[model samples]
Target chain A: MRIAVDAMGGDYAPAQIVLGAVEAVRKYKCDIVLVGDEEKIKAELAKTGMANNPHLIIHHASEAIEMGEHPVEAIRHKKDASLVVATKLVKSGDCDGVLSAGSTGAATVAAKMFLKMIKGIDRPSIATPLPTTHGIALLLDSGAIVDSKPRDLTEMAMMGSIFSKYVYGIDNPKVGLLNIGEEETKGNKKVQATYPMLKQAKDVNFIGNIEGRDIPSGKADVVICDGFVGNIVLKFAEGLAVTLFQLIKDAIKNGGILAKLGAVLVMPALKKLGRRLDVSEYGGAPLLGVNGCCIICHGSSNAKAICSAIGVAIECVKNDVTGHIRDSIAEEELLANDSETI
Target chain B: MRIAVDAMGGDYAPAQIVLGAVEAVRKYKCDIVLVGDEEKIKAELAKTGMANNPHLIIHHASEAIEMGEHPVEAIRHKKDASLVVATKLVKSGDCDGVLSAGSTGAATVAAKMFLKMIKGIDRPSIATPLPTTHGIALLLDSGAIVDSKPRDLTEMAMMGSIFSKYVYGIDNPKVGLLNIGEEETKGNKKVQATYPMLKQAKDVNFIGNIEGRDIPSGKADVVICDGFVGNIVLKFAEGLAVTLFQLIKDAIKNGGILAKLGAVLVMPALKKLGRRLDVSEYGGAPLLGVNGCCIICHGSSNAKAICSAIGVAIECVKNDVTGHIRDSIAEEELLANDSETI
Candidate 1:
């Protein structure tokens, strides 16, 4: 399978991206099309001593989209941008999937503009996998569609459940509506309206409402919400984790000689805990409901994270997750039509 | 000042409440009115050896609201509920303020029913003080009004600023609208509408938009949002903190003999860090926009937390927080009238 990698994206840019692509080609045995400036990509690849590898192919693009530029405007004006080129490769059937760690808005807009949405899908969602006590919970619409309707949320639930089942290997994934309270009557107008619809959905294993406290405890496998709330929750969790870890480090640093000695002894176990909570190992979050599989990584992702993201791309292509989502949406529309006739 | 305590509220009930009231009497030199079942209150007070203390008084309440009951329904049916009676004491001028660790909904409902809203204020908010890297930031509308309008958010901003300046002692509190992005054009429909209003609000020190990550970093002293978002953020932070701490403990436990020994040496420093992040020491969150001061503690609060909440009640009464909110709302209304005429 051929996977297009946006070599110009992310904070580490061509260096880390090229290194990850090389490793992915060696590890996953999949063809990698490195899309970016030819000179910069070739230099990075030469440093890795894999410049002559047959599995790694260089697909040059002249323009690059910076992180701070407006997403739509950037994509519209920068025709030959690396991200745009990578997505075009997928649209032309030259590549099975694409990956980018660039601006989320840019990735989303380019995907919609080029690759387009799946049939019967109104809006696309970014499904983020969060590490929980039991396993991972897929939180969707994580900043994709800011103001989502109840219908949009239901679509997210269906897409999330499908993604979790096929990609994460959770059979009959439990879907939950993110609400203020666990009761059916609780939450804002949007959540309250979406709750009953989700409960009645045949495709979703609706487990009622799950609160913010339930998130860390892994109350549900699939958590659905509007992009606005999901984005805040995702960012807030990241911030809190960083803040708490920093606080712990500061405590050890300020403590006397004995505390420093204790820190040395506990370093191994703390590192283990950090790895367990690490997002890098879990690969990147996917923008669901799109025509092609597009994995978006964190901006600071290293070579390891990018390699994992490539693996995620391979998994999506092999499992035909996009095809399953399309089928599910079509089946739901059929069910609705039959009910209307009755 | 005399503060009425809901002696039958919270998980610990009359025992912890009475102990806290006794401690408040001794430490703050304030009078305490315990409102609950007279017999239960007396029994709890006797355990503290302060049954006959001159600073303590018992006010009988016939009913108690459970945590699971509907807040408004329970408040309506249980007229003599401990929380309702405590609020009545504040309304009748028999007590300076009231404090409860009962169901937040019950406390908010009872406060709204008994104390009523300040003139020109349509909705009340729950302003929760979160411990930040630098001091505290007051997050408002933290579960009071679930579906809030732009006008309600602006009111919350004004009230939060006033409360922070008077109670938290920030000379010029920076009020921020909690949104998904730092840009003025970002966020959901509600947040987008509220941005310009908060910017033009003369009473608030509007600092544009703040993302969820900005909250723990102390980007603003007063963070304003709708109750739906605020409640989720509050609960999520609490859950994440608990989860991370438990994970660290588990790591130490499973890290073998050397790790255990290290944990022993690091115990003191970790305890100090825990104390720094402790929410109980911050007193309790205040229910703003009411006619009287109403401090609401966490349901799992211990005797120390209850005592701190009593201190919060006294602080609000001494600082005339409710009066300031009332004056601010009236001033906003007057300004609106002046602008309309022009």
Candidate 2:
């Protein structure tokens, strides 16, 4: 299978992106198409010693979308841009999927505008794998749609469940609505309205309301919420982890000779712990409900992050997560109709 | 100053609460009134060698409010409850402050219904201390009100600033509005509406929008948000810390002989790190906007947590935080009118 990589994306641009694509092609044995300025991509490819790699190809583009630009407008106006062209490849089935470590908003808009959503899906959801005490937990609608209706939340839960089962290899993934309290009666009007709907959905393993504390424990395989709340939780968790690690480092450095010695002794364990908390280690976030696989990586992602993102793209395509979700949702809809008729 | 303690509150009940109250009276030189079943509190007090402490007093209560009970109804109906009596002591000016490691919702209601909010304050906010990279950060409205208006958020910021300045000992504590992005145009409708309002308020050190990721760095001295989002962030941080520590423990436990030896060598440093992240170590959350000092500890708090809660309560009263906030808001109102006239 072929995957289109946005070579102009991320903070490290052509160099890291190019090297990551080359490594992915060699390691995963998948055809890699690099989309960016041809001259720059070729230069970086030469540096990586993969200038003549048969599995790699280049698609030229002139303009690069800045992270600060408006998403929809950027996708529409910058049609020749690397991100736009790469997304088009997926839309046209020239590539199995598209991966980008660019502006998340830009990638999201491009995916929705070009690839479009599968039939019967009202909105697409973004799901990221969060490392928890039990294992990796899937947090969905991380920052896709800001305002969500009750039905929209139910749809996200269904989509998240299927994605976890296929991509993460979790069977009968427990889906929980993120709320302030574990009780169904807790939370604001939006959560209160969505609780019953989620409970009634036939296509998901519905667990009741899961509190914010439960997210880190992996209390539910699929933790679903509106984009606004979900985004805040995801970013907060990321920030807190980084802050704590920094604190630990500072304490070790400044806590006198004994502390420094202790730090030296435990450096390996701490390093491993840091790696476990890194978002890039789990790959990129998947934009569920789309017709084809689309992964959005962090804009500041390095070479390793980009490589992992490509791996994630391959897994999504191989598992047919989008197709499974579409069919499951369709079955649920048909069953609802039959019950109504009866 | 006299402080009322709910001796029947928290998971550890009379043992922890009674011991904490006796210790507070002896160490802090504050008069303590333990509110609970007289026999149980006295029995527990005897073990702590404080049965004859001159500052210790007992106010009998017949009932206890469960953690899951409805706050408003519980406060109104359970008049003889430990939490209710503690709140009443503050209302009647028999105590300078009230401390409880019980139902946060019930404590909030009791404080509002009995002690009442300070003049010119529309609503009360829950202010909890957050451990940050730089130092401590104060996060307000952690779960007092779920659905908040722009005006409510502005008030919360004002309250948080005052609390930080007085209790946290910061001269001009920077106040920020919590959002998903740092951009001025970021966040939901409430945040969008509240931004200019907070900027216009004369009482606060208003910083621009702060993303969720910046919170743990202590980017701002006071981070303000509506209770819904604030509560989610606070709980998520707590959960992540606990989960990470647990993972560390598991790794050390299962990593064979060499790893276990390394873990033992670093156990002291790890334990110190764990203590730094403990919510109980930060003291109880203060219910801002109340007329008198009222601190709400976690329902599962132990003796150490209860002691910290009492210390926080004394600090709040000594600094006269509620009075300072009320006066500052009044000054802001005057300045707003003056600006309008100009």
Candidate 3:
């Protein structure tokens, strides 16, 4: 299988992207088409000492979207942008999936505009795997489409459950509506309205409502919320982790000689803990509900992060997550028809 | 100032509550009336050795609201509940303020029902002071009211700003609308509509939009959002902190002998860090936009937490936050009338 990588996206851009692609080609044994400016991609490829690697390919794109550009405007105007070209490859079936560590808005826009939505899915969502005490839990609509309807939330629950089962291998994933309280009657009007719909959903293990505190507890395999709420939770967790880590560092630094000695001795253990909490280590979040696989990484991702993202892309394609979603949607329609006739 | 404490509220209930009230009376030289079952309050207070302290008084209440009961139903039915009676003490001008470490929903319901809303305030809000790297940042509407209107958001900003300046001593505090993006056009339809209204609000700094990431950074002194979003962010942060600290402890435990030794040496510094990140250390969040001071503590609060909450209640009463809010509302009306003439 071949995967297209947006070589010009993210803070590290062509260099890290190229290195990650070379690593992916060697490790995963999958063909990777590096899509970006030919000359810059070639320069970065040379540094990897795999410029002549047969498994690696380069698909040149003339334009690149900046991180600050308007997503829709950028995708519409930059016809040959690296992200656009990469997604186009997946749409054309030349590549099974696409990966990008760029402006999430831009990547989502490009994926929707090029790959389009899977049938029966009204909107696409970003399903991110958050690290928990026991395992990983998936939070969907993590800043894709906001102001989601009740039906839209039900769709997210279904798609997120599928992604968790097929991609993460969670069996009979418990899907919970992200709400203020555990009761079905809790949360805003939107989530309150969505609760009954999720409860009635077939093939999905609805676990009623789960609060924000439940996210990291791994109470549910999949947590569903509107993109607006999901995005805030994700980003706030990110920020709080950063601040807490910083506080620990400062405490150690100012704790006199004993603290410094302790820090040196516990460095390895702290590093291990950091890895467990690192967002990049889990690979990129998938922009689920699109026709083809599209993995969106953080814009500040390093080569390691990009490489991990490629692994996720491969997993999605191999497991045929998109196919399962399509089948599930079809089954859901059939169930709805039966209920209506009754 | 005399403060009323809900001695029958919280997991620790009368034991911690009575102890905290005694400590507060001694430390702050303020009066405290513990509202709960007479026998229970007397038994707990006797353990503190200052049972018959001149500044401490016990007011008997026949009922107590359990954490799991429906908030509105419990508050409406349990008229003689500890929390209800405590709030009544403030309403009757017998107590300067009321503090509770009970069900947040019940506390909010009791406060609203008894204390009522300040003039010109659409809805009351819980303004919580979150620990930041530099200092503290206040988050408002932290699960008080959901599906807030644009005008409600503006009111939150004004009340939050007043609370920050008077109680927290942050002069000219920067108030921000909590949204998904930094841009004015970002976030769901609710926040987007609230943006222009916040900008037009008077007596507020109105620093435009702040993303979830900005919260921990203390970029904005006051972060305003609907109660739903604010509550989620607050709870998520609490959960993440617990998970991370537990992870660190587990890492050290699993590591070899050297790691265990390092933990011993760094225990003090880690303890200090823990204290800094501890939400209980910062006292309780005040229920802003209420007619009287109402500080809400966590349901699991211990003696120290309850004492800190009492301190917060004292500060609110001493600074006359409720009176300031009343003045601010009056000034806002005069400004609105002037703007109409212009």
Clash pairs, candidate 3, are none
Tell me the deviation in Å of residue A235 in model 1.
Answer: 0.9
Q: List DockQ for all candidates.
A: 0.75, 0.54, 0.78
Clashing pairs in 1: none
The pairs that clash in candidate 2 are: none
Question: Model 3, range A204-246, lDDT digits (tens) per residue?
Answer: 8998998888888889999998899999898888887777678
Model 3 regions lying over 4 Å from their true place: none
lDDT against the true structure, per candidate, is: 0.91, 0.85, 0.89
Complex DockQ, candidate 2: 0.54
Question: Of all true interface contacts, what fraction is found in model 3?
Answer: 0.71
Q: Mind giving the per-residue lDDT tens digits that candidate 1 earns over B1-342?
A: 999999999999988888888888999999999999999888888888899999999999999999999998999999989999899999999999999999999999899899998998888899998988888899988898988999999999988998898888998899989888899889888999999899888778999999888888888999998899899989988877777778889998999988889988887888898887898888889999899999999998888898888888888899999989888878878987998999
Best by DockQ: 3
